[model samples]
Target chain A: MDRRSFLRTSAVVAAGIAAIAAGLAPLRDLKNFESVEEFLQKHYKELTPEEMKQALERISREVERQYGLRPHVRDLKPMDGVEFAYALNLTRCIGCRKCVHACVAENNQSRNPEIQYIRVLKMPNGTLDMEKGDHNYATESVPEKGFFYMPVQCHQCHNPPCVKVCPVEATWQESDGITVIDYDWCIGCRYCEAACPYWARRFNFTEPSIPRDQVNPNMAYLGNRPRHQGVMEKCHFCIQRTREGKYPACLEVCPTGARKFGNVLDPNSEISQILKNKRVFVLKEEVGTLPRFFYYFDV
Target chain B: MIKNYFRFLLRCARIALVGDWRYHLWLGWLAVICLLGLNAWCKQLVHGLIITGMSDQVSWGVYIANFTFLVGVAAAAVMLVIPVYVYKNKELHDLVIFGELLAVSAIIMCLLFVTVDLGRPDRFWHMIPVIGKFNFPGSMLSWDVIVLNGYLILNLHICGYLLYTQYQGRAPSKWFYIPFVFVGIVWAVSIHTVTAFLYVGLGGRPFWNSAIVGPRFLASAFTAGPALIILALQIIRRTTDYHVTDRALLTLRSIVQVSMLVNVFLLLNEVFKEFYTGDLHASSARYLFLGLHGHHALVPWIWTAIAFNLISMTLLLLPLSRSLRWLDLACVLAIVGIWIEKGMGLVVPGFVPTPLGELVEYTPTLNETLICLGIWAFGLMCYTIFLRMSVPILQGKLSKANETPGEINRVCPAIQSRTATST
Candidate 1:
């Protein structure tokens, strides 16, 4: 090469190196890297029984290392012959927002930039219009005047728009009618987040900053397991508890017996009775999500 | 055959590397911007998308907005392709390659914008074909992934084949490229249509659930895409010895004129429907055009874009735009106008009122803006480099016969005109 051409080539090389060097500066802040096991982990459905066991063990170790909490994590599968459903008594709900806090605690949601799945919209009595509902009704409130509380979470829709929009099969409807997300598998594109009419999905924008003591020990792989900085989490109907035959954290914590949860398949279940007896309606029925969750009024 | 291809690539790389001070400066400026973007992306990776203006409320923001617009730009290559291949317009025969090159760069930018928008970019392989669980056909996003990557490859093949054949000083095989060129024209339309489908298929976001989105996307893309080409062609004519005719510019102007009119009409149609009905579903549209419940972050943006669009349309329609200066101004206005209209104006409003009837305004952070600008700079740099190499090949200066680097720089006017006319 001539002197002029050699200078040009050298200049190109120097600029590239400098650019790469400058680009690498901010990477010092990066604290997380996928472990080999985590990186090579199979999809939720594709995971064999033994691979799943090992994966669960790795998660337990990681959680212990991070929080000093040796949590009891499990891959809670749906029960056969059971399809879960929820019903809420809008008249009985007082809009206290205890269920919101209870959900956060149970779900291991981020505390710093708060991620709450349940939004108890305080709607005016005059109209059932969701547009009229106030999400930020700040007062010493217990069913203020003509306003009634309607708590909304993931409907776990039969025709889930969120599931349909997921570019990867990161989220899917379980056989029991609950929509579950494989947190590990989610690409965090958040297409599912945009597709949900109910605003049910939540994304972890940063590392979840849960208090050490506050970390719930009983975790489900698909539910309350601690999420990394950049994955989605939402109300999975408290999969850790519900699949084990316990009521959801929100349902259990409600002061008014407004929240109801049971197997819709069982004729004697409270949800089944409510479905038969009450004047029930699903939110945004026009959107055609066909939610497993329903709202009812005691007129 | 492989050795000859490698030799062609090396010559191209050398041509790209060795340029005048102005070229060095332009490349340097773009490099700095790309590095700035890379720095911002690294920070985003570290801190997560918390650094961005996006929240659970406004799930997607600036990145997706830019992604949407760049997809349109990539699809706009069809405007030139139609005239050249389908209509057999001789004026645009030589210029269509530039459009294809621009598409290649624009698609690269689109992919970058999508990558930066992703929250868990580390898990990107999860969407890959076999190893990953790709939710094809079911997900519009999966369809987007396929169409976009496919379009990129199609344009690359068409551009690369044409340029490499030119370097070999041989007539390009009609069988090899002609079929692909026709496929590319349909593929271009499909790319933008699929991107529109990504928004329109979402029944939850009423703002994006209109039937007009698909058509509006195409209309705006054709307008903006050709407008960009007009500006680029002018720049090429002024800077390089590349022959860009007034007739070619006029043809592009006409394409821009018709598409701009349709784009403006579609906007008006959407505005009338939203404001007339004034229902709850029109909350997002209200938020865009007029402040809904006194929170209109996008009112100024939408109005500004509309003004630009109207002014550009009027200029393009008028005989005054026959002059190059007025035409250039109109093109710039159209590009900026459509960038705002198609990018932030479309993407942000869809998430403004949000599905839950909550009002959370989205404003891009400094980091986000830098990343966006960086991708644009990177794209321009790529286009510049592509042009730098291809212009020489087109002029018969860099070819198999003129193998020596010294001889490649010598202007052969006789060979240049013959090569130009033959192609």
Candidate 2:
């Protein structure tokens, strides 16, 4: 092509991009509508009861049309008033894996026989236990021993490293101190998986292996929805259930009442009382993770 | 004459199949079957990573280790290139193309290994575009992508120009030769350094956070890469009419001797920092070399690596071994031992007791092993095709290279349009 035509074509492409940028950048300051922040910041859960019911119906219809199957989709998940917190009694945890099972059923994770959010480690008590723990342990029985349980999951750190390392900005911390992942946006690079000191992040290697009847009907859009293959997922502090003032199933089912769930900000809440009466601590204090969940000896 | 023509046709077919066509074909078929096996593993995409031997406890595994090893192979080829192309050593000059081609193959393998380790492959394009997803500036991921892609382009450009000139029966342009030499050296160093940065900057993994990691990687890469090139050349020497003198081979041995010495010295420096003080930081190396909690899995492999390196260094260092026929055999042994030792021995031990204080053993899955073999076969296949394409150019027989770079710029229809468009 001639130079004049080449220059003209290049200018036309540049103008097309400029037009799109002009349209979107000023849409933030819409006088005809509300502000972009005002539009986006309205928590989906804060919608009117009628609006939430409409969303549920829309999603159920969409799922059936797309998958040729009906998936339970409900948005009774209220978010205006309630907050979530979790506390663990260090002295009571026996590494029974019951909490792990309770999480699988309650959170509606795939019954692949191995997936679990909580990992109770048989950490050696006292001595220089600097760097020795087994992650791939297949010991079926919880042996009676001089071992302390270090229940590990996402710390929901105030300065979360996983969030900073995400190339796609797919993971973020919320106002309620819960860290959540955008399952659709996550590329499964596992850079965050490496960045996390806690090893809490898990990758979807294939489609989740849930039987059709067992799949959870009530789903959160960004929280615990059936994740796509090759994305990262982790504990979201059971955000979907906790947003509605309901206890996480794992906390509800704990036989020893070992788990305590409440809001940390409320001075009169059970976790706040537990923090005052008991010497509670978060793991990896040296790394400055500032964990929301705490473990205490005599809560 | 007809019989000769048929024989020539058969040889070309074999050349298309690459070296030891029957053997290469057998391995190639085996690799194809392994892709079917990968389908079974692919079923775990959503089942969560629970499908693999890897768990929340043993978060990273065989995939990462192979990534590290393949990077070493890619970086190693520069050892051959720099001496020949930059220094213009007459003995090594003719062999530089082989190194460049070898590097191109290794880089492709490195990329494939990284892909295999991903939780999802469909979202790979998330790293592309001039926009949102692939955070380029501050990320080690961006550094990896840039340096790797840049080196591949640089080498292919150099490879094509060299062949093109030889085909046209012309001496190479001063313009092409000068820039290629400068970039070749930088490109050689960049592959391993970027790979080292992947681990070294991670402050959490105590095993990988050493400052000397970059230097150590380069030292191993330079030594092993040349050893691989030399071994490959020896096979080509036996099978084909291409020939190099004994003295030229001896010069290569000396380069390896110096490289191995530097590599071992660096290892000693790393070991000294780990053991000099009785600190807890010293334990990761100790755990790898001596069994931690009585698990001595990597011991035999590391020891064999040490022995082969020592034997190869001895032969290279000694004047008598340089002349001995068995010296070549020793070189082959050292190269194989180092490839395994670097690939598994370095990678697995570094992550043994992970940052979370989890010690999970890693044995490559059968699919991972088979796919790795397939990658190697594919690389060899590429080499054969490249050589067939390259041989005529190298021997000064192609039509394209007769014109000067300036002449091609002036008269070529494509170049005229490109320059006109720029105007």
lDDT of 1 at A29: 71
Error of 1 at B89 (Å): 0.4
lDDT per residue as tens, model 1, B189-219 = 9999999999999999999999999999999
lDDT of 1 by residue, A1-299 (tens): 68997898799788789879988799887777768889888899999999999999999999999899899999999999999999999989999999999999999998998999999898888887777789999887587998888899999999999999999999999999889988889888989999999999999998888889999999999999999988888899999999999999999999999999999999998899999999999988998999999999887
lDDT tens readout by residue for model 2, A148-206: 66677777888787776676566877777788886645767777777776777776655
Question: Which CAPRI category fits model 1?
Answer: high
Task: Show where candidate 2 strays beyond 4 Å.
Answer: A1-87, A92-96, A123-147, A164-169, A245-247, A255-278, A288-290, B1-56, B59-61, B275-284, B324-326, B354-356, B399-423
Candidate-wise lDDT, in order: 0.91, 0.66
> RMSD to the native, candidate 2?
11.9
Clashing pairs in 1: none
Which pairs of residues have clashing backbones in candidate 2?
A72-A217, A204-B45, A205-B44, A205-B45, A206-B44, A206-B45, A206-B46, A207-B46, A208-B46, B167-B398
For model 1, the stretches where C-alpha displacement exceeds 4 angstroms are A1-12, B405-423
Name the best candidate (by DockQ). Answer: 1
Model 2 compared with the native: what TM-score? Answer: 0.77
lDDT tens per residue, model 2, B1-423: 343233333333444544566545654464454444344334333243445565544555666666666677777767777677667788877877877888887777677767766765555665664433655555676678778888777778887667655654567797976687578678768878987887776655666778988898887777777777777777656655576566667767777778888887888898788888767665567766776777667777777887888787777777766763756766776676667666666666666666666666766565555555555656665665666656544655334434334543433557546555866
What are the TM-scores, per candidate, against the unseen true structure?
A: 0.96, 0.77
